[model samples]
Target: MKHVIALDVGGTGMKAALVGAEGELLYEARRETGRERGPEAVVEGILAFAAELRGYGIEHYGEPASAAGVAIPGVVDAEKGVAVFAANLGWENVPLRDLLTERLGGLPVALGHDVRTGGYAEGRLGAGRDADRFLFLALGTGIAGAIGIDGVIEPGAHGGAGEIGHVVVRPGGVPCGCGQRGCLERLASASAVTAAWSAATGDPRATAADCSRAVDAGDPRALAVWEEAVEALADGLLTAITLLDPRTLIIGGGLAEAGDTLFVPLRAAVASRITFQQLPSIVPATLKDTAGCLGAALLAWDLLDTEVRA
Candidate 1:
């Protein structure tokens, strides 16, 4: 079977894997990005990770892979293989594709936005696979989304689309890092949920995970905080549904890990908001943290296959 190396670069770490064309991971590894060292250092870390995957591929498949796919958190110029901007990683206009190509000895490389790749994986092989139209919403430290329409993941102009978190949820509520007050992220993101609970109870120690656990344990403060987040998230989903009318809403990232603690109330809130409109079924992501890596691999496969045909 043909194989490709896939890497998902995040602010904290990088996940690398050698994957078969059939989506089976042959080998995987993880390493910290050490992002504080700057963009070149982060790129070096990725190259090293890819080199390890190359070594693993040679050990198992008898030859190093000729293609690689990498997903990075931020606005990625997929057509140019440039990471346009990564606020968390403090990068700007990095020509990652050219560097990866040189490092991999002229091998083909596919670069993409991290969230878009995750949505691509879900649309092709995970929870959103069966839907002709779907939304991949990830509520992590911040919130973002990806739109999958008819099996095509739309990255939009400049590859910065699907930033649903920037949408205003409250008119004059909490301020957001993006210079907006009451943005969806301010009310519904993991950080926001934790902050809300913390402020509500004057407990600086309270966190989103703690609030989730509290909600699970019937803590009223946790319940109230979670309820507010769920309601805000539902409002955002309601707006997305009205516009995109997706068939499925795939929820992923750290916040979604709360399972029923997050989903039950979220689903109900969504149900309560819709009257004449159709409500998309909400489901958790199946690929978890690996979705971006797998999707990057798929992108690599697609790019290489297209080149071969050309």
Candidate 2:
């Protein structure tokens, strides 16, 4: 009946769960990140959320949680257990792991980058489970990626590796918040497609989902928008494939919900672009939004193991 608390803190909301030793989810919950209120408020919200989950585990299992894990966006120093920076949350250099451990009565807490942590789940339990090497991409409002090797997500030397979204595919095309022009996310992410589709149809509210439906209906304008995004994505992915040579490519996040609409053309586009690089299996992710929580649990469990070994 032992369990750990898992939390995935996103820009707008947080997903949490109580996970057993065998990776079974005992309970799940969600909360607004309260980012609009301010960074300090957001930190307090996360602490409160983790405390509540810990309380639930104690009440149900008659013991406190063994450990806790959290995944947050932006720059994170996992080794230092500090959330270095998160633009969406307006946070900088917050000692999140220390804060959580203090809140949970000294329970060990692991902090990770959201995309990389989610890819850890996908690598071990989802589409990348069988691959020795894989790249997991989350095509959300903004694209992000994780590189997995030998069942582990590589944190890279500085912990900023696997940032495929920042790969420049369209030189001098569009400006990115990261201070780059023609970054992959600006050209190929869900938000990019939404912007393109909205401008094309003169509907300010048109979304990437709407574009997908229109593509299904054989709308030429939607086809144009989708194709543009697909082509840019292919260009970016080709760079990853060339550099990483992964055996599998797992696609997740909101835009990935398009399923075949995104996959079929994407596969063809990548195939057409690749010459010397071996084409990796382009597959859709199975965990959806829950991957982050599951991965956070994995981190918590890993932390417990490391503690026992030490």
Candidate 3:
């Protein structure tokens, strides 16, 4: 059976799959990125991993992978197939697409920003599949967004568009790594919540999930921290709604896994803050952690379609 390679490269690990033409995952695998070994090592690891997947496809499916797609973290220049910069991975202007193509014996390859790819999958195949316009927010260690329009995620000029995390929500509040104060991620992300809860509980290992449990138990301190996060998140989302007017808003990532603990209050807060902006249906992402891998598959399929049309 013919298949394509889909890879999602994160800071610490990579998720990959062999996807069939019908969008089914034929095979899946995971590997460590070994980022601590430096940028060059990471690149070599990616190349090796892609090559291995290609070989596995050939051996098991009796056909080589026709194409490949890679979703990577950081500022990516998708048009040029370059990974612009990834602070966590220590990458700078890496020609990842070209390297992968060459390593995979010239198979066509598509590279994209990780979050944008995930949003694209959500727009085309997940929560926002039916919406003409949507915004996908991932509230993990850090917050990031993807803007989907007419079933496609817009990468924006310079590939820096969906940086909703950096939006100033607190003004003079917390200091951000981007040299800003009170950024949305500083207050609303899972990491931020974990830090606050940990500080409050005097337990260095306390996590956001712990806070959720505390809130469920009616702990006043946990409720206070959770409410603060919800308020900041609502404020940031309101700013996005005012600017984009998306039809649906999809929330995913670790914090989103809190289920009603996060969404019930979040929906109410967002609703209360809205004045004239059309209220968007706030929903959870269905694809979960697999979104990025599936999204990479979509990119690979798109590359094949583009080639056929050309």
Candidate 4:
């Protein structure tokens, strides 16, 4: 009846799951992060949520969780278990792993970057499972990447390795939130597509989904916007391929939901641009939204194994 606690904390919400030893999910829950209430409240909410999961495990399974893993957005120093900074949650240098351990009666906890953790799940159990080296990119509100090598995601020297979003794809074209002009996120992310569609269609509420519909309907304007985003994305990805040489590229997030509308042209665009680098098989992510939670569970399980070995 032993289990691990897995939590994926986002800007506005948190998803948690109790996972059995063999990776089966025993229970799942979701809660608001209450980020608007401030950083302290968000921390408190996370602690309380973990505690509730622990209680639930003991009540339902007759055993408390032995370990925990937490995935948080923004800059995270996984080795030190510190959440370096998360603008959405107003966090800075928060020692989240130790706090969660203390709240959970000294249970070991593994902390990770949200995107990296999700990519870990995808690499181990989803799109990149067959590849020794792969890159996972999520094109959501913003674009981010995780580099997976031999089943492990590399966090880099400063825990900021796969930040492909900030890479300038359009020189001096558009302003980015990171104080840079023409970032990849500004050009290729779902939010970017939605913004373009909204402006083009004169619909203030137009979303990326609407843009996809328009593209499907053969709307020339929507096609133009979609192709523009795809081209920018291909440019950014080419830079990554030249540097990393991943065997596979896994694409996920809200925009990827468009399926062939995004992938068909993207593969061709990337193919046309490659000069010397080997072409990577670009595939859609299979795990979807459950990746982060499942990956947190994987981290918890890894920690547990390490502890037992020690």
Candidate 5:
């Protein structure tokens, strides 16, 4: 069986897995990104991770991987394999693809944006499996989105199409880390939820999980904060639905773990606003945190198939 090494690089950690052609994981490993250091150190960490995976593949499977794929955050030029800029990681115009290829002796390599890859996996095998058009919203430490249509993932010009997090859900409400006021990330992201709840209740120790627990126990403040987040998210989704008319809207990332607490109100809010447009299904991401890795491996497999066709 031909094996591929898939790497999903996040702001906090990097997840790696050995995936077969059939989308099965044979082995996996991950490490903290140590992003506070710098970009070169991050690249060195990735190389070291890949080297360790190479050793594991050689020892356990009796050979090296057929190819490798990597998914990264920020603005990624997948066709060029360059991360144009990653503000969190302190990287700009980094040639990650060529760097990895040189380190791995020129084996085939594929690079992609983290959310786009996650959307690809969802469209192909998860929540959007049957939908011709769908949107993937990731609400983790930060917020972003990905769009898929007709079984094709459109990365848009400059590879930054589906960034709905900066949609200004609340005008002049709260400042965001992205140097903007009232971006959706500042209102509805996991961190934002925690901060908003803390600020509203004057409890400095409150967290997003705490807010969810309070909502479960019928705490009015927590419920109000959570409801505001859901409404902002709904407003953003309304615009997306009007434009794309996606058949499904997949919610992924840490905040999505709230389960029904997040989905129930979200669907209701969307339904309330969406009268004339087609109402889409709001579902949790099936692959969870591993979607990026799986989709990266799938991109490598696509490259393999393309080579065969050529």
Candidate 6:
């Protein structure tokens, strides 16, 4: 059975799979990224993980993986197959693609920004499947987005596009690690909600999921926190909608797991704020946490197809 190795590299962990030509996941696995050790350690972890997957394919599938793909956090020079910078991983201008290819014995490898790769998968196989234009928002530990146009996720000129989370929705409100004050991400991300809920309950262990539960129980404090997040997210989304005019908006990541708790209010809030902007069809991503891994597989398949065509 022919297969390709696919890996999704996150700040703390990695999801990997061996995908058959028909896009079925022949095998799946997960492991820590080992980022706590250091940036170099993280790179080593990724290389080791990919090599292991290659070996697995060779053993179980009767042949070595023909190609590999990885989706990673932070700035990526996809065209050059380099991970430019990842603040969380403390890396700068890492030639990650070459390292992975070399580790996998020169297998063709494709590298992409994590959010963009996931969004592309959503556009192709999930919520935004038929949409001509859409924006995929990931409300995770930090917020990020990818603009999908005609089934392709646009990587922008500098690989920094679809940064809807960075829009200053509340100037001078809260400082963000991005060195920006009151960016939407600081107020609307899952981590932001966790922080707000923790501070409100005076419990360091309180999380965004707790906040969502509290909201379900009609707790005023949780309501306040959730409301703030929704408002800020709406403002930020409006900015994107005005600029992109996407026909659909696919919401994903941890926050989206809130389901109606996040989507109901989010839709209402966005609708309440729109003046002339089109109210995009807001929908939750169907892929959940597995989107990145599936997307990585898609990237690997795309690489193979491109090579065959060339």
Model 2 scores worst on lDDT over the 10 consecutive residues at: 169-178
Task: Write down the lDDT of every candidate, Cα atoms only.
Answer: 0.90, 0.95, 0.95, 0.96, 0.90, 0.92
- The residue ranges of model 6 lying beyond 4 angstroms of the native Cα positions read none
Give lDDT tens digits, candidate 6, residues 38-101. 9998998888888888888888878999889899999999989999999889999999988988
Report backbone clashes per prediction.
0, 0, 0, 0, 0, 0
Q: State every prediction's TM-score relative to the real structure.
A: 0.96, 0.99, 0.99, 0.98, 0.96, 0.98
**Candidate number with the higher lDDT (5 or 6):** 6
Return the clash pairs for model 4, or none. Answer: none
Residue 227 accuracy (lDDT) in model 4: 93
- Which pairs of residues collide in candidate 5? none
lDDT of 1 by residue, 201-247 (tens): 79999889999998889999888889889999999999998888889
For model 3, how does the per-residue alpha-carbon lDDT over 67-93 read when each residue is reduced to its tens digit?
Answer: 999999999988899999999999999
lDDT per residue as tens, model 5, 1-310: 5689899999889999988889999999989998988889999999889878877888898888888999999989888989999988999999999998888777788999998898899899899999899999999877889899987788888788899899887889788777889898888889889898899889999889899989999999999999989999999889889988899999998889999999999999999998789999999999998899999999989988989999
Clashing pairs in 2: none
Candidate 6 weakest lDDT stretch, 10 residues:
17-26
Backbone clashes counted, model 3:
0
List pairs with backbone clashes in candidate 1: none
Residue 300 deviation, candidate 6, in Å? 1.2
Residue 54 displacement in candidate 4 (angstroms): 0.5
Model 2 TM-score, 2 decimals: 0.99
Model 6 whole-model lDDT (C-alpha atoms): 0.92
Tens-place lDDT per residue, model 4, 154-205, is 9898899899999999999899999999999998899999999999999999
